[model samples]
Target: MNGRSPRWTVGGPDLDLADPHFYTDPRHHGIWRAARDAHPVAWTESARTGGFWSVTTHAEGSAVLRNPQVFVSGLGMRLGADPRGVEAAAGRMLVVSDGAAHRRLRSAHQSWFNGRAVAALLPVLRRQVDARLGELLARGGPFDAVAELAEWMPTWVLFEMMDIPGPDRDELAGIMARAFDDADESAAGAAGRTAAHTEIFAYFAGLLDDRRDCPGRDIVSSLATAEAHGRPFTDDEVLLNCDGLMNGGLETTPHAVSGALLALARRPDAWRLLKQDPGLLDTAVEEVLRWTSPALHAMRTAAEDTTLGGARIRRGDRVVVWLPSCNHDERVFPDPDAFEIGRRPNPHLGFGGGPHYCVGSTLARAEVRCLLEALLRHVKSIEVTGDAPRRPSNFLRGLQRLEVELVPEAGNGRGAGADGEEDVHVHEAHEHVRATGDAAGDAA
Candidate 1:
């Protein structure tokens, strides 16, 4: 065993926690292997929060999520150098509250994401997917998929479904992005992060009050008028719920859409296979979840001291679970690094596992299915034209600018193909709705 960490180290797990090597570089290999083999549960200090434990194996990690009585989500910096500070700043937000409290908080809006509600959203999602693909074509040729297509696509759909005031939609989205970055960048030990989150909550509070007095048909209206715990939600619940929806759906769905497009750019044959056989769509989505493993990691704090994979963790210590590492674990998956459509028992933690599984996973899936299904209909090939700028923060693994050509096969469809093309335009709207910065903060 490697003895205690040096006093000078940035963070534990014996790696450069500050630079984000885990996500952007191959250096993640040994660090993860070490964590998997011996140090499944470990502790480390961060500049912002002092220190926390790092959880890397599937069984042990799943244990933490399943037993919320023992661990709470949203303690913050699940995989960074700043646990003490982030945890200190945690508001016991929905993502952090455990057990009964989590139940009470989540109950405020869980029904809105139930299967019935999600199934009702399919038509709208498909239409939006169809329209957006057409819009990309109409706008014609070469386009930045990440910005023009990937970044705004799902957020726009979410805005419409949430019945967010279309006028204030863009600004609200920016606020959500700022809040997300705040949590992500806390490793830099910035005090402004808390203030930003507060600002986001205040704006959401005002928005919730407006929805109550002038309820409309959107999600805001639903939360305002709907009964929860025998009456309309309390003010805190209402505001936090909207904030949750915004934070939950904002960058996630978009990343899923774009991450797949990214995998395709590098693996043309996969796209070719999908275009020839659309039945692979379902498998393709799973493949994307496995290969990209969005959401990076989820953090949980020990309710009491525990041993994981033989590693002893102290009570109240923070443990970070690496979703991408688990997804790529050779122990659970064969060729874990390769993307394949027919991967069975995929069992990915992409949306997380156990009770806290992403509430909008079904919605996110349908949205991606429609988007990819539509993307294939429009573009024939996709290729990266230049060095893509990765997102600003380390937690999200995506490109800020994915320059590509959309070459439309003349007889195939009246649109552009995936590789690289410029000049075309098409647009449409969705009928239903539902559900990032930095490179160094990605996954291991």
Candidate 2:
């Protein structure tokens, strides 16, 4: 059950996990398998930003992620991150903070993402999935699902939840997209990223100020009015966390959705299983999250000297956990490469682990489940039409473009319920899904 295919040969010295190009190559998966087998906690030398240790196994990754005290996030959470920028974001941003500060910051946003809160959002999410998918199906032509369908629902939901003005959404989303662009690391790319961050900071600053005087139910207003560690969050703290929330909310779901669709197109059998048994939506959603592992890796710095997976460590050492690799670990998941919708005891860390586990996880699962539900009710079949280009980044494994034709169901008449209300099926399977506790992790 190691899932080690015959094609995966051991990578030689030229293998560099830090390179973005390394991920896009088809050989990357095999390389990871080879690395995991050879050295689960091997030290990787990166020409771009010195070197770091790569933790590839599920057990080791969970250990590092859960023990944030030892593998602190204050230094940086990704490769090649500027030290100055990481220092600035350390305590203010939830993703990079540690201990009490992390807990307090996470608390401010917890209520909004709790099960009850996510349940309230189900209607809105269903409507969004229906409207957008309805339009695409009506068009009756091949389309890039990434642009047309995958990206819209999550973007719309995040903006709506934040109460961001309709007019400003497109511009803000563009900026946010650019802010996290790891595809190109050239000088121009760096400049574009910096510019995007600047715009995002400014946008949130204005929103925070407005909410300070006149608060509302939106996240901004909550953060604006809330206090942490005996004092109200300063403008910088609110602004930083706002940036983090925006990134977290918008980044993970779309990639997961698109990846799910691509997986379905490739494995029609899985789609058929869902269509036959609508109750399988919960487990299918879990399978999607496990398969995608969108946030490729998350980094932490050693707070003090430590030993992990028999590797020697020192304080301030950088440790990167490859999430997708961990998800594919043979020890954790039997038949790791196979896409099994009915996978039980699936403890994949697609959402990450420990203190920084995704606050938006409940909402994330609901979003994916609703989309899949909509597809099952409406789409008859999915076929890949053209090239599906993956986003080139060392951090995110997302589709830049996914060209596919969605075949509509017969006699469904736009897939609306007979009563014309949202035709979502509520099943006991959700309890199991919730129990699995799989989540979409932080944007870092």
Candidate 3:
């Protein structure tokens, strides 16, 4: 809440939004609450990432997102910025592009990510959810939900959508996960990051070549053949946009589901209610998105001298909008901290908003809803078996490990550890498939 510019307030209690420590601990909430109450648009100076404004309140954060013209993304939408410069080839990606370019790129893939598109994929997603959950339930107790189920859900779905082969899919997933999770700035870290990017870009470049020769029904091929703003997308634009979709598809919804599982385990009453009435999943999914707010914050550069939440913002200043704070804004939701499954009119900024809103919103909702429906229908109870380790990432609030003991419902149970007859055949089949995949991936 200091009145002094960030330059003068360097050694003060400057909020470093890019720090992974705040995300893994409880201190982030208190800091954001103070920002919301006293300095919704506070200045923060970090030696690593330089100075930026912290936009914490719901109204002001939403305002910054909606008014993309005033708060631009072209300078790079990430903290520490994009070290390679914003105008680099990959800068044309959907997350950092603005104005006409943004619209054009988004429009190219809009049809594949709309509500109808997701609805069409409902059967496929449900089967995937059931298969994964069933395998986890059969394994008995104390399972890491992230490694066993949450992480696999979106990777399978996204791979299917993009027409990536099974062997390559797992490798690419590992590469992308490492690239995003590695926020280190050391020389070795930089080299590793560059190698990952090189591998990914080279991989996609091959896909682009294939698509150019023979376009298919998949997303990448569609993008290759599609036009944006009266001309076909350049190779660089295609590569960046494809990479952007992969990152977006992989990260957000899975973490939200893991959070929801933790929430349900803590509140048995909410779990019981959802179990009784499965139709409440739509509202329940919205509440989970709000409660988790996985994509923690997004950066925007001020396009002109402006004011936000009563604080003056100068042109060229970096503004980080804290989505978690906005979702928990007291002014918007009553009992904002409580995990209310039936929360209505939850206008959360979890998937962001306005022109740059996540195009994967529809798919994310469908994926989360499928998981909830599967959990409600199959499991009788979910108890926390051990400590749930949170992933250390400033931008992503994910669970690294969530050990849960799941009790299956009557008649549907089929395992020695559970209260039913053992299904050795199904368990062995799942293991075989898993082993095969692991071997193939290792060989690659």
TM-score order, best first, reads 2, 3, 1
The C-alpha stretches of model 1 lying farther than 4 A from their native spots are: 1-14, 18-22, 74-92, 182-199, 392-394, 411-444
TM-score: which candidate is best?
A: 2
Per-residue error for 235 in candidate 3, Å, reads 1.4
Error of 2 at 352 (Å): 0.9
The lDDT for every candidate, in the order shown, is 0.64, 0.81, 0.77
Model 2 spans with C-alpha error above 4 angstroms: 1-10, 413-444
In candidate 2, what are the lDDT values of residues 1-444, reduced to their tens digit?
222222112476676677887787767888788778888887776678777888899999999999988998877888877788889988788888888888778767776677765676676567668777777887788999998888887887777667788799989988998999888879999989988999999998888878888886677877788776677888898899889888888888889999999999999999998899988888988999999998999999999988898887778778899999999999999998999888888998988888878788878888899999899878999999998888888988889999999999886536443233422322222232233322422332
Residue-level lDDT for 346 in candidate 3? 95
Worst 10 residues of 2 by lDDT: 1-10
List runs of model 3 lying over 4 Å from the truth.
Answer: 1-15, 89-91, 183-185, 414-444
Model 3: per-residue lDDT, tens digit, 4-96? 342222224554566766577766777677667776777877666777887788999999999988998888887864557466842478888
TM-score comparison, 1 vs 2, better candidate? 2
Cand. 2 Cα-lDDT: 0.81
TM-scores for every predicted model: 0.83, 0.91, 0.89
How many clashes (backbone atoms < 3 Å, residues ≥3 apart in a chain or on different chains) does model 3 have? 0
Residue-level lDDT tens digits of model 1 in 224-310: 776645655667666665666776787677777778887888888888889899988888888887777667678777768666666
